[model samples]
Target: MEEKVYIQLKKKITVEHNHLIKLDHIAFVTGNVPYLEQVKNIKIYQITEQDKNVSVIDGFHLLDTLMVSYPKLAFDLIGPNQVIIEVKKQERKANIFIILFIWLLLCVGSAMAIMNFHYDVSMQEVHQSLSLYLTGRETEKPLWIQIPYSIGLGVGMILFFNHIFKKRFNEEPSPLEVEMFNYQQDLDQYLIHHENVLLKNKND
Candidate 1:
């Protein structure tokens, strides 16, 4: 009877840039201890080009490689059919001026957008009308009501985003964060499918 080998693949793996990829880096293998060590360290791929950052590896490719070396073992692979591998690189510090500039631009743009929206909706006139009913006075500017409303608008934005700078009010993800997470998931799926298709075409 053949020894049984079980391999569990990770959905995603991160490896250092410009390094040779081994089976153990992307998966977990269990079987004969001596044979397993050799099986785990089998050179499956190499990251040579600096521009090539992401790879979607097919599970069968790993199976084929293992079969060539340890054909006697009955092998079983578990987990996702395709694995995504990303190159890990050193992080560089961003310039402070650029960060400040972007922050300032967003603040100014958002303020302008709010002002334009209020103008288009005739918000001031509506506020003045409400002031007449509440205060029993006809005034050009309803400082009492408008001031509170303005502060409330800012506060509402902060609450809606669920962030005050880097601090979060609650454990719940904000709308923006949820949207971003969805986008990332969609992008990853696309990369996996497209890369697999390209690899299939190239082999054909």
Candidate 2:
């Protein structure tokens, strides 16, 4: 009886440049087959300097290559039909000056946005009117009401984001985080589709 060789192809694999793309790097190849080590180390492709940063490898192509060398072995392949090999981009070290600059910019921008909104809606006049009704006095500035409202507005923002600096107030993801996660998922799917189309067009 032919020995069973299980192969679980990965959906996506990220790696560095200038490396031999091996079966072991892309999939999980297992089962007590003789020359299993050889099967796992099969040189499926190479990420050369000349090659593009992204490449797609189909499972069918991999299977055909394996059968040529080990026709006697039984293969059980699982997972997605194609695998994406992408070169991981190196990230630059964080600079404190850049971070501080961004922080200041955002702070100034946010304050200006809030002030514009308040001005548009005549918030100060509304507050003055409400203060006159409650305190039975015509006041130019409602510091008691405005101070609490300003503090509450800042607190509300923190609560909405569910984060304060690097610390998270809750386990649930914030709205911004959820949006970013969705964007990443969409990007991955697009990469798969785009790469597959390129391969098909090349074959044609």
Candidate 3:
């Protein structure tokens, strides 16, 4: 009969810069730096090289940087860390007037597009007819109905985009937020795929 030995190493590690943590029954490693275990369950690791690097975003870095072997359990760990990132202050010079001009142009262009589309479809005539039917009176401009409809447009836009006022409606995501999240996911996947392709090409 053979004796069974079970050793379970942590598959995840959370660490901070220049902080010591208990890595008991687990061996932690990162950035090709050999991490030494102090005492029984104590481990110390330091973070260096702080500049805006794509590999490290904000103050967090994810690394599959741990390996431990005892008897039965031996695997790698996906270690993530929030470390001190020292960013060099680079003074950025920008033309604020130019940026404002472009923004104004965009707004004007969008308004023009919408107005042109509505005019092409004679939406004003539809509005006039709808207003006449609602008010049961022949008028040049339907100020009563049109005013409320205009107000409703703004309110509807706010509700559609934000879902609520002050507080949210449970866990349900707003239409805009959902669209933004989906866009972010697609962008991430696209960037990852392109990065892999670029790496493959470089290797080739």
Candidate 4:
């Protein structure tokens, strides 16, 4: 037999400015069942029932409450897990692109250096032959200036492409979507606990 589940809101309050303020709230769905039969059932029930008074307006409410109650904590519980996941994914892709860009710059720079060296040698040979036939000398550019110039040009091009890619592809999650994602996770966990409790009760 399929049993019905109930949704409940739990609220926790803390004293702020000498007045009681709702610290955090969690919305959980659970079925009425005996606590002893199911392991962790009591704890889940206590977590939900204890916070029943605080209204959960959005997923971030839980994290906001935690942040408000615990000032020293660094992580924001209000943000959706999906947002964190997406941001991490975006960063990974950006890093990969950055690495590829660097590799391409190195390959192109190496090819250009080889070509320039060959061209310089060819020009030198022509100049030597011409100078031998005439009463003139050949002028050569310094290697130090040429090498730095080529490197600077390659670096500048890579930077420009990186900037363009960031502008075109980089995206951050919106506040609402993050909240929704968090809410969904909480709701699912709550329902699962409730179902398990009901199932245990039915078996008993």
Candidate 5:
């Protein structure tokens, strides 16, 4: 009778979860009979009359462990190992001042363009009408100076508000995401190991 053999190959596993969940553990059945012996520090077991199964025992815990111990290796194995990481979306606080400032700038810029195109009137006249009582002969600043100063102030305000907006909104990922990604990576490696074993058996 032909000898029966089972080969061990790596398997691939994938994990999925919302931003709120984290990976815990994964388990799977193997075609090979559980080995009751250890060889060269490895757990060796026969899968069939002619084939065997060997766990890369030393490396099982080394999956996502790369992120902390070996970041480069972690990145390399992430995609190929069939790991899936999903980060939960976090609700960030909105900056009211930033929103208002942006709206004001947009309105002012649009008004300036519209006024320049349609009014056909001097800026001095517009200022006088807008500040009739304030611009009475008591004012020391000339209309030319006031106009440029106002424009400069508006530009400065816009730049300042934009800086604040970026500071508030460009937040880093929460700790949960990092943990979940690492957990998923580990699951992927285990699956990959099992898949490799199955393939090896087919070829043999």
Candidate 6:
């Protein structure tokens, strides 16, 4: 089946902030011309996947003043792809008290774990011994070797998990994302198999 084009704004818009006005908010459009005119804020996009047609033009009636008088102009400018309309969305505010409470708990828990581990086995002494064994002589602070190794650890993790740094990291899923996609695919297959088994049992 031919893939139906999908279009959506990169970010959710909020009228209070006028975030839609920013050009960066637009994901991708088939054409450059703004199909819908706006006083300040709006975005256009074209999706590659096939889905149910979602017409945003209906919402344009609300902003009839901003829309072009001639409907032909939209057809000439924007292609057949259904344009996803961006509009102000009502959302709940984050609870700072809850956030602070969780953050405090995590910090305290991590600190206690680290302290307990250090008490059981002195990491500083271990580092000194390892450094002496490797280098023949140990420096006052093992930070010289530890710092670079720690930095390398983070770099290695990024390289392993996310390979493409400069190019699109979103359009192309990461390794973990690919694994998740495969897992979901397998789950769907199992669900279909189970449903078939249930139907066979009913028939019997």
Q: Name the candidate that leads on TM-score.
A: 1
Candidate 4 lDDT tens digits, 4-89: 32333443222222222222223343443333123112122122332332212233333343345435434322222211000011
Clashing pairs in 4: 9-52, 10-51, 10-52, 11-51, 11-52, 11-53, 11-54
Q: Model 1 over residues 1-204: C-alpha lDDT tens digits?
A: 457878888888888888788888888878755567877888877776742778877888778777878777778998777778887767778999999999999999999999999999999999999999998999899989888899999899999999999899999999999999999889889878866522653588
Q: Write the per-residue lDDT of candidate 3 for residues 105-172, one digit (tens) a residue.
A: 99899679868987899877888898788878787876776678767866777777765566765677
lDDT of model 2, residue 104: 100
Candidate 3 Cα outliers beyond 4 Å, as residue runs: 1-103, 163-171, 196-204
**Position 126, candidate 3: lDDT:** 84
CA lDDT, every model vs. true structure? 0.82, 0.84, 0.46, 0.41, 0.40, 0.46
| Model 2, CA-based lDDT | 0.84
lDDT of 3: 0.46
Which parts of model 1 are misplaced by more than 4 Å? 32-34, 196-204
| Number of backbone collisions per candidate | 0, 0, 0, 7, 21, 1
RMSD of 5: 18.2
The weakest ten consecutive residues by lDDT in model 1 span 193-202
Q: How high is each candidate's TM-score?
A: 0.87, 0.80, 0.48, 0.18, 0.20, 0.34
Q: What's the residue-level lDDT of 69 in candidate 1?
A: 80
For residue 104, model 6's alpha carbon misses the true position, in angstroms, by: 9.8
How far residue 34's Cα lies from its native spot in candidate 4, in Å, is 37
Candidate 5, residues 1-204: lDDT per residue as tens digits? 322212222232222222121122121212222331211123221233222222222123323232343243212122122222222234467799999999999999978885685357575555555565655553433565566866886677655444444353335544554678889767666645653432444357
Model 2: lDDT of residue 41 = 86
For residue 75, model 1's alpha carbon misses the true position, in angstroms, by: 2.4
lDDT of 6 by residue, 35-113 (tens): 3333123432222122122113222232232244333333222222222323434566879999999999997996688
Q: Rank the candidates by TM-score, best first.
A: 1, 2, 3, 6, 5, 4
Q: What is the Cα-based lDDT of residue 37 in candidate 1?
A: 81
